[model samples]
Structure formats: structure tokens, C-alpha cells
Target: MSGQLVRSLLIALATALVAVPLGYFVAPWLGWGVFCLGLGLQLLFHFRNFARLDRWSRHPVVDASLEGEGEWDGVFGRLYRHEKELRQQIAQREQEIAMLIAAGQALTDGVVLLDLEHHILFCNRTAEAQLGLKIEVDRGQSIVNLVRQPEFARYLSDNDFSRPLSLRPERYRERVYAIHVIPYAGSRRLMQIKDVTQEDRLDQTRRDFVANVSHELRTPLTVLAGFLETLQEIELDTEERQRYLQMMSDQAGRMQSIVQDLLTLSSIESAPPPEDEVVDMSRLLDKLRRDAEALSGGRHTVELEIDGKADLLGAEPELVSAFGNLVTNAIRYTPPGGRVRILWNRTPLGAEFAVEDTGPGIDAKHIPRLTERFYRVDRGRSRDSGGTGLGLAIVKHSLGRHQAQLDIRSEVGKGSRFAARFPLHRVIAQG
Candidate 1:
């Protein structure tokens, strides 16, 4: 504004100097005409500058870089500075947005942002993989159309969002997701998807395990109760009373076995891992052999083979229980006079304690679940043999504590070999 005022005064002074000379030497009329022409020229220049500024503003995006002299120059410079400031602000906001998106991508749970119209605005990589969505391709598209699940559609449509919705997305590899819809900004929502398949399976397994335990205990208690009622109410001969007492004793023993095994399992699972130490494998196996022979009472032929001299490094009690359980299982499962062999050997991978039994082997289908508590290939036969179904499960847990694995291989009519293989780190070579 100061520059414009100074320039205008200079033009007027120059015009007046020329006009005064014209009026003194020539004519007053000619001096007046020169003054009017000079003023008209000034107005013309002002209008031209205004037109340039107008044209720049008329476009969708204004170019604030128009070069000019005097007042116009200052005006153009200020506009350019303002436009640059606006651009910088926009760039900074975009950078922040990118950082937020990157953080979301690093999360395990899927995150998605939706507009009021249910159009997908943004989604993280987890969301894309978990929900079968293409982050880039699916933007601006209706989320419901892509999901294609009536339950999911209903979940979205429902206004009550106190809890998350859980359902399997059939379109995407039968994955289970816990979807939480959080409403914000009037009608906009943030949808977060969490994959809960493993969690759900564990919950179901726990429920089944608890139910199985109840059923197992109920049967023995019911048997005992019935026998006690019979003994109290009815009179019987000495032999008959002895038989009834013996039957009750057997039922009581069954319940005791179940309780002991359950306690063992619970203790192993709850206790912290045992401190590692060297264990004499030969001595342990010898003790286990003697126990098996006593349990067998010479009915089954028990054999022990020490292939490689390597003492194991682990909790002695756990190792003893694990190895002894395998050996006892062989003795219990095999028929009278069948051979039950216990082998301690060192392989390239590690040392192994394997028990091979000559009995009715397990079916291929039952091998996978043999370690589950109370799971049996033949329940009636297991009970008849005084075998608690938890024996194999205990073996599994004990070996797991030692960082060992149980490999069971069996064939019908042949035999089954249950091997507890220990890693080299757990094996110390002995002379």
C-alpha cells in the first residue's frame, strides 16, 4: 500500500510539471488535456493489475506467483507465502496419517475405519488378511458387499455395540473372528477384527475335559453307592458278602486311581518347570524294569536293551515318571506271556527310551489323540486291565517338561512302540 501511494504521487507530480509548462508557454486547454490523459493512464495500469489478480483467483488452484511491480508485486508475494504455508500444513497432516497407518499395520488385530455410509475408508494389513479384504482396492466400497455374510451384515446393522460379534468368515479359509464395532463421530464406526480360532478350540477342549472327568468319577461312585445300599439292606452268606465287599473294594480302587492321576496331571501343569540336573539313565531303567516285572508277576516277558550309554539331563522324578509310565503301559496293554521290551539308545538327534509291546496295537486313527486324558481306544478293555486312561496323558505331560517328544507307532495285531526322544542338549554321553 505504501509503494502504491508513493508511485501514484510521483506520476501525478510528473504530469503536473509537464502540464504547468504547457499552460505557461502554449495553452491552458492543452495542459488540462495532458492532466486528464495522465490520470486515465494511471487508472488503466491499476485495472490491468486487478485483472491479473482476478484471473489467478478464478482458476480451481490459484497460482500465487504472478510477477509485478509496485503494489502488485507486494500483493503477489504475500499470496505466494500464504499458499506455501497451506501446502506445508497439508503435507504434515499426510505424514502423521501415514505414521498412524504404519502403527496399525504392526498390530495383530485387524483395524478398519468406515464412514457413515458404511464405505471403507482405511484398513490395516491385518484387517486385509483376516477379513479377505484388499486395502487399496476395497477403499470407497461398501464393506457389507465384500463380506457377503448375513450374520456379519446383521452385526453391522445392529446398533447395540456393547459386545463383540464372533462368527466364521466362510469366504476366507473358515477363520473365526471377533469383530468389535465402535461408533464414533456421530455415525462413523471403527471395526476391529480379532482371530480367535485357537482360543475357541481351547475353550471347547476344556469344557469336554471337565465333562469327561465328571462322567468318569460318577460311574465309580454310583457303583460303590449301589453296593453299600445292598450290603446294608439285605442279608447274605459269607461267600456272597465277601464277593460284594471285593466288588466295592475294586470300585473304590478305580476311583482312587482316577484321583491320583488327575492330581499328577494337575501338579505337573501348574508347577514351574523343574531345575535341570544329570540323571543316571541305566540305574533309572533298571529300577523301572524291576517295578514292571513285579507288576507283571511273570505273566509278561519284560526285556531291557541299553544300546548307547548316555545319561539324560533333566528332572529325575519327571524322567522316571515319564519312562516308567511308558514301560507300565506296555505291561498293562500286552496279554499274558507277551513280550514287552524297553530300549535305551542314543541316535543322531538324541537319546530315546522306547517301549515296544506285543499286544493288540492301536488303530491308526486313535494314535493322534492317544495322549488326551481319558481318551481310550477300548474303554472296557482298559478298565478290565486296571489301566487308568490318563497314563498316556501323564507320559505326554512329563516328557513335555523334559523338552522331549513321544512318538507312537503301531499296527493292528502287531505291536506299538512308544518312544520318549530327548534332544542332544538333554543327553550326556557316559563311558
Candidate 2:
């Protein structure tokens, strides 16, 4: 038995023994009455202790010092210690839950937790943005209803979570997401979402790059191969033979140009940023004018205008190649009587090296992609003009190395202007 119970029994036994003997010594009725009085007093004492216990129970505090008197102290002390341990365990569990939530929120990928019925239980901030969900509002809503994609609905129904689902959400049509569902904690599911728009675009671009390169190189190789077979198999006059040789040479040169341009672009992109080297803007402008005039071959009127005396700070060779491409493009596109003006001017933002041409201008839609490799507004016309289609792309990368930007402003039938604007840090004012 407990110590409190044993003590109470002994106290009761002692009370009965003392009361009965004393009462019997005086009178028999008195002995019985004394026993009854002792019993009643004992009952009253027990009731008073019970009332204190009840009060403690109504507003119990887990404190070691908060206890009862006599035998009840042990009972109150044990209860307080047990409650303290229980509270500590509860706080520990709460802390673990908080840490788990924090870790989920720190992830870049979206995460959603769902019950067996696919009801949304928890979703992190990334999930909220990617899937357009409000945790507070959508907490018990079904995932199928919230996503509302037919394919996604089908994927869930099929229970084939073996492969991740790749889809563009209707709300975010431009972005692509890869979704994976893992069945965990019995029947509940964990949904993970990763944004793969850039990866997808890069993959597509790689495919297009390979296809375009093959197409461009194949045409010239085929022409050269056909003519070589002709020269070997057929007998021809000296004049015809010379003409055929010239055509073969032209094809060879075209292939060489394309290869050279590709190599230049690859080098520019792969190489580290060029060391800061002073470039003479005045001299560069003069060289551009000469190169443009030579490339023009009296076809267009080439003019040079220098309104800025600021020298640029970058690799001169890269600057030459970039600025030269702009001039060459202007001269090649402008008509025989038209004007091609190469201007080096100071703007509010920075120094601008612009090539303004009275050529057939570009459409607005085509201007944005003009700097992409092998991108041409008109493929036939570009090929006829003997362009490798990588000039603007080269210009773009080269300018990027110098902290510059290529700005193309064009309107159909109104001619075009291509400008390379250098940052203020790159411009050195001549004294």
C-alpha cells in the first residue's frame, strides 16, 4: 500500500484504541459514544483534505513546492513532477514541428502535402507562387480542384507517379513546371514542383542550333561536291572550266566565312571578360569609315560623324570587330545612292557608336531577335548579301564584354539605326 494509505490506517487504528479504552474505563455507553465521536472527527478531517485537493485540481500548477500537508504532500508532489515532464515533451514536439516547417519554407522548389483524399494539408510559399494556391484559403481544398488541369487530374487518377509530369500551368502559360508525387506516411502524398522553363528553352535552342548549322554548311558542301564531280567527269571549254572553278571558289569562301564567324562567336562567349585596354574612339571611327567605304565598293555614300571625344576602355580588337560589323551591315544594306552614316556621339546615358542606314528597314517583330546567332530577317536576301548571319550576334557578345548594349531602332520603310552604347565607366573623356 502507499505510504499515505498506510499512515491513514495506523492513525485510525490508534484513534479507535485510545477512544475505546478511555471510554470503557468511565461508562459502556460513553465508550461507544467516544468511538463514534472519534469516527466522525476522522471523517470531517478527511473531508476537509478532500476539499483542498479539489481546489488544487481546479487550478493545478506544476510546482514542486505546491503540495498538501501530511500524507497528501506525496500525492501533490508526484502529480506536479509528472505534469512538468508532460509539458516539456509537448514543447519539444512543438519545436520539432516548427523546424520542419522552416526547412520546407527555405526550399527553392515548391512543396505541397496532401492527405489520402488529396486534400491540401500544407503548402510552402514557393508552392503558393508556382501553383497559385493560398494556404490559408485552400487548406482543405482538393489538389485536383485547385490545379484544375485535365492531364494533372488524369495523372492522379492513374496512380502512376513513376514519372514526373511536365506541364505549363494555365495561369502561368510561359513557364514550365515538372511535378512529382511521392506516396508517403501511409496514403498521404508529397508533391514537389520544379521550374524548368530555362532548361527547356536551352534544350530547344541547342536542337535548333544543330539543325541550322547543318543546313547552312550542307548547301555549300553539296554545291562544291557537285562541281568537283562535274570537273572530273565532264569535258568542258577553258571558259566553262574557269566559270565552274570560280563558282566552287565562291562556295568555298562562303563556307569559310560561316566557319570563321562561328569560331569568333564561340571564342567571344567562352573567353573571360577582356582586360581593360584603352581604345581610341576617333581612330576607330576613322577605320570604320574606311572599312565601310571599301565594303561599299562605291555602292553607297559612307559618311563618318564624331560628336564625342571620349575614348572607350576595352580590348581594341573586339571593339574593332564589333564596330566594323555595324558599319559593314549598314553599307551592304543601303542602296547605291543611299546614305550610310556612322556616328560616334555622346548621349545622356553614355557614349553611342551608331550606324544609321537608308536601307530597307526591319519589321518590329524581327528587331528583338536580330542579335541571335544565324537569325536573319530574310534568309534569301541575307545569303545573297554574303552575310554569315552571325555579325549582330558577335557584336552583341563583344559589347557585353565591354559593359555595353546594342540598341536597334527600326521602322519598316524608314530605314534602321544600330547603336552600341557604352557605360559611363567605360568612357574616358579626352583632354
Using lDDT as the measure, which candidate wins? 2
- Of the candidates shown, which would achieve the greatest TM-score relative to the real structure? 2
Model 2 lDDT-worst window of ten: 60-69
Candidate 1: list runs displaced more than 4 Å. Answer: 14-18, 26-76, 115-117, 172-174
TM-score for each model: 0.88, 0.90
Give every collision pair in model 1.
Answer: none
lDDT of 2 by residue, 1-431 (tens): 28867877777787779777877687777777777777788678778778977887798767667777777677677878888998899999999999999999999999999998889999999999999999999999998999999999998889899999998999999999999999998979999999999999999888988888998999999999999999999999999999999999999999999999999999999998898889888888888898888888888888888895889889998999998898888877777889999999886677999999999899999998999878999999898889999999999999999989899999887799999999888888899
- The root-mean-square deviation over C-alpha atoms between each candidate and the true structure, in angstroms, is 3.1, 2.6
Off by over 4 Å in 2: 28-66
Q: How accurate is candidate 2 locally (lDDT)?
A: 0.89
